[model samples]
Target: MEKNTILEQLRAAKAAHINWVQRAKMLISGFKMEEDAIPVNSTQCKFGQWFYSDAQRLNGLRNNPLDCMSEIEKLHFELHDIYLNIYKIYYDLEPQGFFSKLFGKKKKITDDSVKLAKEYFASMEEVSKKLVNEINLMERRIVALPDTDLETL
Candidate 1:
């Protein structure tokens, strides 16, 4: 892949990671402010279920044989790795997602992580936009190249 394309991919993946960080914060806040934001009313309301599901899907696809991996697969792995790394970077900011903690004296770590992640993303977003512009310029150059005659080969 081209350097600009790779940068674009990184930007997109980072944006997504940043988005999730915000979402996690919102969920955590809801869990905290509400008396029962995540009640046992249904399996869908269980945060653990969604976390496990996401983690499972990510791990399963990421562990595939290297030889069999396609560009998209590699991108997925790269994106997943970026997210995992960012999560660790701000993981300490998130509070334990437990009902007792949410309603009790515990502060929300998710909110804190999201705040920091947003700043990180904002800076990276500028780089991503620049990369996209670079990729577009490169594509224009490729398009301007002379067409080869396949029949002459």
Candidate 2:
């Protein structure tokens, strides 16, 4: 591929990733606030759990596009590792599905779970910042490359 074409693709990926991270942050923040508003033991809390599960799934899905970009650029970004960590935390906090709730197997959302959620949100924010930095560095490198070297690639 031509250098300019590759750079354009990278820029697009960067924009998409940034937007994804921003949306994720908004979801997490909204969920956190909502979760805090409801009593942990209330039946209504189940809805929050469901929302969290969906958010986790969404976050997991978002990681793939960024990973593709990372692979294409031959760079292993810290965001990828952080996303894995976030996934693990979500897995640990996985909410009971409809059948599980119907069967009375709902997991209790304790204060510890709330703390963990906050930690997860912080980790996600960190990943977002790191990803922005990494993308900026990648863009700088691409821009700095000589025309001769760019053409060779």
Candidate 3:
């Protein structure tokens, strides 16, 4: 694949990851109070799934440029676990009538969920930043390759 093609894919993944992180933060920030407002539901689960999906994509992109992909893949799995944990918590909260039980009519969340979301949010943000930085470095290397070297590929 062309270097730019790979970079573009990485860029798109990073963008999606950032969007999810922002939405998760909103959940913690109380901007989204209704269970429907949260991104963890079936039809609106993009933000929740982005953590796992982006990590996988990042691993594929890194294999061409990084020597130690195993470590990177481990990091991705860690993030995926965190995402799944958040999803699990939300799933449990649903049957309890979380919207009415927590905040009367306001649909407030449990303190525990807030705490977990914050922790995972910080972690996902850090990982996404690191992956984007690595992708940038790889792009620089690709661009600096001599024309003859490019032709050999």
Candidate 4:
């Protein structure tokens, strides 16, 4: 791809990463509120499951930009791995079903779940920052390259 095109894609990816970070923060806040609001008599709180769905949607938002950069740099691969890990963590914490719902057994949020969510959000924020930095560095490098070198690139 041309350097300009690559830079444009990187900018888009940076934007997506920023948006994802915001969504992740919102999810964290929502999760906390939901955890706090769970009634003693309630079973099968939908918060965890809702979070999973929302997280999946947020994950999807980056797919287009990420796909565009798949072959551009190793950093893209690292970002992909980080995204997958986040999804895996969320998946593991997905609410239990069937019997618990039927029996009115509360799907209590364990300390482990809270810890994992906090860690995952932090990792996601870090990764997003890294992506933005990488994009900025790439833009600077591209700007610094001579016309001949740019043509060759």
Worst 10 residues of 3 by lDDT: 42-51
Model 1 per-residue lDDT at 111: 67
Which of the two candidates, 2 or 4, achieves a greater TM-score against the reference?
Answer: 2
Query: Per-residue lDDT tens digits of candidate 1, residues 22-41?
Result: 44345433433332332222
TM-score of each: 0.33, 0.48, 0.54, 0.47
Better of 1 and 2 by TM-score: 2
- TM match of model 2 to true structure: 0.48
User: Higher lDDT: candidate 3 or 4?
Assistant: 3
lDDT by residue (1-153, candidate 4, tens digit) is 255654565466556545545655665554432322321111122322322332123224322232322222344444445545444443334676888657755445556765776776677667656656755765575555444443432
Give a tens-digit lDDT track for model 3, residues 53-153: 53234344332544333443454455555655655544444555665567654433589877887887788778756655654564575566443443323
Best by TM-score: 3
lDDT of 2 by residue, 1-153 (tens): 355775766666566565545544553454332222322221223322332332122223322232333432222234444444433433324666788656755334556655665676577566566655766765666566555554433
Report clashes for each candidate as comma-separated counts: 4, 0, 0, 0
Point out the higher-scoring one by TM-score: 1 or 4. 4
- For model 1, the stretches where C-alpha displacement exceeds 4 angstroms are 1-85, 89-108, 149-153
Candidate models: Cα lDDT each: 0.39, 0.46, 0.53, 0.46
Indicate the worst ten consecutive residues by lDDT in candidate 2. 34-43
